[model samples]
Target chain A: MSDLTEGPSGRRRGRPPRTESAGTRDRILSAAREEFSERGYEKTSVRGIAKAAGVDSALVHHYFGTKEQVFAAAIEVAFAPALNASEVIEHGPLDGVGERLTRFVLGVWENPTTRTPLLAIVRSAVNNDTAAAVFRRLIASQLLRRITARLDLPDAELRVELAAAQLVGCAMLRYVIKVEPLASEDVERIIARVAPVVQGHLTGP
Target chain B: MSDLTEGPSGRRRGRPPRTESAGTRDRILSAAREEFSERGYEKTSVRGIAKAAGVDSALVHHYFGTKEQVFAAAIEVAFAPALNASEVIEHGPLDGVGERLTRFVLGVWENPTTRTPLLAIVRSAVNNDTAAAVFRRLIASQLLRRITARLDLPDAELRVELAAAQLVGCAMLRYVIKVEPLASEDVERIIARVAPVVQGHLTGP
Candidate 1:
C-alpha cells in the first residue's frame, strides 16, 4: 500500500489545518482559565492571556471576540459537565426527585472542577453587575429551565424554582461562604437530611 | 422665679448644644443611606455623602469614621428596628412560627427603607471582597447568630442556619434578581407558601 493523506485541497499536505487551529483555540482557552482563576475577570486582559499562552494578541481576538466572551467560555467549560445533571434526574425514580436533585447538586459543588469555576463566577458576580447578569442568565437558561421543563406536575415551574432557591441557598452557605458544620458535614449525611425538604418542595402539595 | 433655667451641663454655652447632635447624627445616617443606595458602597465617597447631607466631609468622618464604618452604621440604622425578630419566634404560637417568620422576612424585604440598603450591600459584596467579608461577618454575627440563639431546639443552630439560607436565597432571587412569579406574587401568598418549609426545617424531626 502507498502512504497517502488528505490535505486542504484533498491532496497530501503538511499537518492538518483543522488540528492546528483547534490546538491554538484550546491553548488560548487553557490560558484564559488560568488567568481568570488567578487574577479574576476584571484584572485579566486579552493581551495578558495571549502573552501567557505564547500567542499573538490578534489571535486571541480571532478565537474569542471580547473579554466577556472569554469569560463566558471559561464559565461554559467549568459548567459543561454540570449539564449532565439531566441524566441524573432522568434515571432516578420520580418520587424521590427531591433527594436525587439535592444529591446531584451537592455532588457538583463538592467536585473540585465544578467548585472552583463556580466560585469564580459567583465571586465575580458579587462584584460586577455585568458579571451577575451573565451569571443569572446562565443559571436560568442552562440549569433551572431544563430542570423545570422535565418536571411532570401542574405547578412544576414554581416547584422547580423553589427547589432551586433551596439548593442555591445551601450551596451559597456551604461552599461559597463556607459556613461551618454544613461545609464540613459528610455528603451522604447532608443528602439524607436535606433530601426530604427538597423533595417536598418539588413533589409536595 | 426670675424665668431663668440652668443648663444641664451647668454652663449654657453656644446655642445650648441643642441635643441637635443626635439629630445631626440621624441626618447623616439618612444621607448615608441615600448615598449607599443610589451609588453603591464603592462609588459613594464620604465627601459625597456629607455633601448630600449639607454637612462638611469632616463631620461625616467624625460621626462614622471610615466609609466601612458609615456602611456599618447605615446598616445598623436599617436593621436595628427589625432585629427584634426574637419576638416573632417567642410570641407567636409555636404551630404558626413558620408563617410568622416568613411574613416578617418578606415584610422587611418589601419595605423600601430596608430593601434599598440591603440591595446595596448585596451588590457591593458581589463586587468587593472586603465588602463581602464585612457582609459575611454581619450576617454571621448579627443576623444568623441572633436568630439561631433565639431557637431552643436540639438542632437549633443547624436549623436556624438552614432557615437563614432559605430566607436569604429567596430574597436574592425575588428582590435582587427580580425573578418572576416570586417578584410579582402577593407577599402574603409567598409567606404562606414558604413559611411551613422553613418552620418544618426549624422544628421538624
Candidate 2:
C-alpha cells in the first residue's frame, strides 16, 4: 500500500505540496530577477523562469501562486538585507537617525548586487504599471511606514517621508540616471555630504 | 463628386485623416489622466479610455498610437509650461538660483492643473520601467541638461544634480506622498524656507 501510494515518483504528492526547499526557492527567485530585469515583467513568463531555474512548472507554481507573487518574492529577497535598515536606526542614537539612514541607503546603492535589482525596479516602473504599483505599495508599506513608525517626534511621519523622498530621488540620479559626479563619487564621500541633510530632516526642530 | 469629397465623409484623404476632434483628444487626455491615476498604466487600456471619453475605439487609436506614446504626449502636455524654466533661471541673480528654482517648482505643484499629472507620473514611475526611462530621459534631456548647461561653475553638473534632487525630493513628499505641514502649508512659505538650501547647492561658494 505504501509502495503503491508512493508509486515510483519518490514524492508524496496530492497537489505537489505547498512548500519548497529554500535553495530551490532562492534559485527560482534569482533566475526570475534576471528574467524580469532583462525582459521586463510583461515579457517574462513562468515557463521561462522555470526553465532558467531548472525546475518543473508545477513546482514553480506550487511555491509561488502567481507570476506577480513570484516577482514580489524576488524583489523581497533582493531587498531583504536592506529592509532590516530599521535595526540600524533602532541601535543608533535617535539624534543621528538621519545620518544613519543616509549611510545605510547610500551603502545599499553602492553595492552592485543590491543596486542592480533597484535599478531594474525603477527602470521597469515607468512603462509597467503593475510593477510600479507593486513598487509603490512596497515602498509605502515596508520602507516609509516602517521607518516613520520608529521615530518618536511630533512630525515623525512627515519627516520620515521627506527623508525617503530625498533618498529615493538621490538614488534615481546617482544609480538609475548615472548623473555625473554623483554617479562616480565614493560612497563615504556621498554619505559625508548628504548625511547631515538627512539627519536634519530626521531629527531637526 | 464634389459633395462626395466634401463634408464629414470627405474622400480626399492621404492619411485617412484624423477622425478625432481636437476636443475629443482633449477629452480623451482628461479621461486618461483619471484612468492612469486610478487604475494605473497596465490596467488602463485605450478601449477603457475611449469608453470613458465617450468616443469610438478607432478614434482613440487614431489620436494616440500606443499606450506608451499616449503617456509621452500626456507628460509633454503636463510639463509644457515648465519647458522654458531656463527663462526663470536666466532672469534670476546667480546667487538666488536655488530659491527661484525651489519656488518655481513648489509653485507648479501648488497649482492644481500641473499637480495632477505630476502626481500620476511620479506614482506610476515605481512599477513601469519604460515610464521611468522616459521620465529620466525627459528630465535629463529637456530639463536638467538645459539647466546645467547654462552654468559656468566647475562642478556645475553636480551642483545642478543635487539641487534637482533636493527640489524633487521635497515635491515628492509634499505632493505625492502628502506629507504635512509641508503638504498643506502655503507654497510661498515653504519656498521661503527651502529656497536658500537649493540656492546654496546651485550658486553658493
Candidate 3:
C-alpha cells in the first residue's frame, strides 16, 4: 500500500517531498478523529484538525478535500473492520449468515480500539445533519449495498437494513446508552440470544 | 389528572395561586421541549427554558427542580404514549406480544406530534451523557421494567432490552439516520417483517 501513501506526491504544489507521507496521512486522520470526538461535528474545523495533527492546513486539504470528506475518510478507516462484515455474510452459508453477521458486527463494537471512533461517528451523526447525511451515504453505499447485493432478493435492501437496524440498536443500548444487563452482559451471551433474531430477519420466513 | 397538576400547589412558597396552573405547567413543558430541541442537552439551561416559556426561572425550577429534572419531565411527557406500551404487552395474550409491542412502539414514532419531541430526546441522549442517563433510567424504570415484570421470566429484563435494542436500532435507522428504503418503507411493511424478530427476542426460546 506504499503506492496508496505515495500517490499524493505527484501533485506537488511547492510542498516538501518526504518518504513519510503515509505516516503524515495517518497522523492527520488520527487528529481528525480526536477533533471530531472532542469538539463534535459543527464545532470541529479542518484548521483545528491540522493544529491537532501538527501539520499545515494545506496538508490537511491536500489529503482530504473538505470537512465532510475528512469526516468520511475518518469514518471509512474506523469502520474498515466492520465493513468487512459483508464478506462475513457473503462467504458464509445463507442459513448461517445471521449468526456470523451478528457476531462479526458486535465483535467490532466489543473491541475498544474500533468502538471509540465508532462512538464518535454515531454521536456526531446523531447530533448534526451534515454528519448524518455523510454517515447515511457512506453506510448505504459501503455496507448496506454490499450486503443487499449478496442477498439477491427483490427486497434484499430492506432485509439488509432490518438486519442492520437490529445490530445497530443493540450497539447503541450496550455501548452508547449503557443500559444495564445488555451493557454489562457478556458478549457471547448476547450473541446467543440476538443471533437468532438477526438470522430471522435476514434469511427466515 | 387535576391532582397531578395541582400537586405543586401545596409546596407553593410565595407563588400566586390561579385556576390556570395546569395550563401554565403545560406551557412550561411545551417550551422546555422546544428549548431542548433547539439548544441540545449541554447548552440548554433552565433560564433559557423559562425565557422560552415566558415564565420566571424560579417557576421552571418549581415545576422541575434542575436542568436534568426539566429534561426528565419533558421526556416523561413525550414518552407518555410509549410508556403505555407496557399495557399493550400486559393486556394482551403472550403469544402475540412481539407484534403488539413492535406496532405500539413504532406507532409512537409514527406520530409527528410525538416524534418531534422524541427525536429531540433521542438526539440529546445519543450526544450527551446526562441525557443518556436520564433516558436509561426512565426507560428502564417506566417502560422496560413494566415489560420485564409482565414477562415473568428469569431473564425477562435482558429479554426486554434485546427487544428494545431491536426496535431502537430500527428507529435509529428509519428516523434518526434516515437510511432508506428502511427510512421510506411503509410502517406496516416494516412492522410485518420486524415484529417476529422482536417476538423472537421477547418470547421465543
Candidate 4:
C-alpha cells in the first residue's frame, strides 16, 4: 500500500511511449478493483478486468503482468491517502499520534469513493491467501512499522497493532459486515469514542 | 465459540432409532467442520464431507439436511463456548463486565483446539456473503445483544458492538492474520492491555 513515489507509470515495459499509457493503466486498475471487489479474487479473471476496462485481455497482461500484480497496484493506489498519514504521524507530537492515526485510518473508510477500493482490498485480503499476504506486507511493513518506528516507547510495535486492531475491527464491523448501529452510527461519534482507547494504547502507562 | 448446552447432537432428526445416532451425528459434524474450514462454502459439498467422515454422502444429507445446515451446525459447535460467555457476562457486575468479557473472548482464541474452527469460521465469513450473514447474526444477537441487554442503558447495543469491535479486531490481527508482535506477544500481557479498553468501551462515560 506504499504509494511508491518511484512512480509506477515510469516503470512500464513493452509499451509504445504514448500519452494514453497512463490513462490505460489507471483504467485497468479501476476496472480490476471493481471486478475484484464484486466477484472476488478466485473468480475475477484478467479477461474480465480487461473487458470491464474496454481493453484487450492481452493489454492487461502486458501492463500488470499478472492478476496479483494488478491487485497489488490497486491496493497501493487505493491506500495512497492513508499511507500519507504515516508520514504525517511521523512528524506529529507523540501525544497526538493516536488521534492522528485513528482519525486518518477511519477517515479513509469514511469516504464513499475511497471506501470502495479499501473495502475491496480488505474483503479480498481477509479471504484470499495471496491477498492476505499483500495486505499483511503493506500494513506490517509500510504502515504499522513506519508508525511504530517513530515511537521510542517499549512494545511500540505491539501498541501500534493494538491501535490498528481497534480501527480495523471497527472498520470490519462497520464496513464489511455492516453490523447495525456500529454500521449506521455517526462517523464522528464513533471516532470520538474509539480515539481515546487508541490514544491510551499509544501513550498510556 | 461457546459450546451450546442445548446439545447439538440431540437435535438430530429423522434418523432411524439407532443408539449410535449421537456418535454418527458428531462424526458428520466433525467432518463437515474440517471440509468447510478447508474448502469454504462454495467448494465444500455434502459428498466431500461424507467422504471425509467415512460415511455415505446420503448420511450427511440425512444428518444435516443441506450443506448450509452442515455449516451452521459446525459453527454452532465451534462457537458454542464463546457464545456461553454472554450468559456469564450477563450476571457479572456492570463495572467488572468489561474485564470478564475481554478475558473470556481472548481466552477463546488462546485455546489451540478451539482456535482452528474459530479461525475457519472467521476467514470464511470474511469472504462469503452467506457466511458473513450467518456470523453477523450469531455474534450480534447471541453474544452482543445478550451482553448489552444487561446494561439497562441507552445505546447499550452500540456499546456492545464497539466492545466487540475492539476484541474481534484484536483477534483478527493477533490470531487470524497473525500480524507481528501482537501475534507473538504474551497472551496475558495482551489481555491485560486490551481488557481495560474493552472495559472502557463497555462501561465508560
Name the regions of candidate 4 deviating beyond 4 angstroms. A1-20, A43-67, A87-103, A149-152, B1-20, B46-67, B87-97, B149-154
lDDT score, candidate 3, position A176:
90
Clash pairs, candidate 1, are: A126-B126, A126-B127, A127-B126, A127-B127
Worst 10 residues of 2 chain A by lDDT: A1-10
Instruction: Evaluate residue B74 in candidate 2 and report its C-alpha lDDT on the 0 to 100 scale.
Output: 67
A1-205 per-residue lDDT for model 1 (tens digits): 0111212334222223575566766777889888877766777899998998887776666666688877777777776766666666767687878887888888889988778876676666655566556666776778667777777777666666677677777887777655665667777877776788788887888
- Among these predictions, the greatest DockQ belongs to 3
* DockQ-best of 1 and 4: 4
Q: lDDT values of the candidates?
A: 0.71, 0.69, 0.84, 0.79
Q: What is the lDDT of residue B143 in candidate 4?
A: 76
CAPRI class of candidate 4: medium
lDDT of 2: 0.69
Q: Is the docking of candidate 2 incorrect, acceptable, medium or high quality?
A: incorrect
Instruction: Flag regions of model 3 displaced more than 4 Å.
Output: A1-20, B1-23
Please state the CAPRI-style docking class of candidate 1: acceptable
Off by over 4 Å in 1: A1-17, A31-61, A66-68, A111-113, A126-129, A178-189, B1-20, B23-68, B81-84, B111-113, B126-130, B144-146, B178-189
Q: What is the DockQ of each candidate?
A: 0.30, 0.22, 0.74, 0.54
Per lDDT, the best of the predicted structures is 3
Per-residue alpha-carbon lDDT of candidate 4 for residues A36-88, written as tens digits (9 for 90 to 100): 87977778899999999988887787777888888777787777877876786
Better of 2 and 4 by lDDT: 4
Worst 10 residues of 1 chain A by lDDT: A1-10
How accurate is chain B of model 1, given as a TM-score from 0 to 1?
0.79
Return the candidate ranking by TM-score, descending: 3, 4, 1, 2
Ranking by DockQ: 3, 4, 1, 2
Best by TM-score: 3
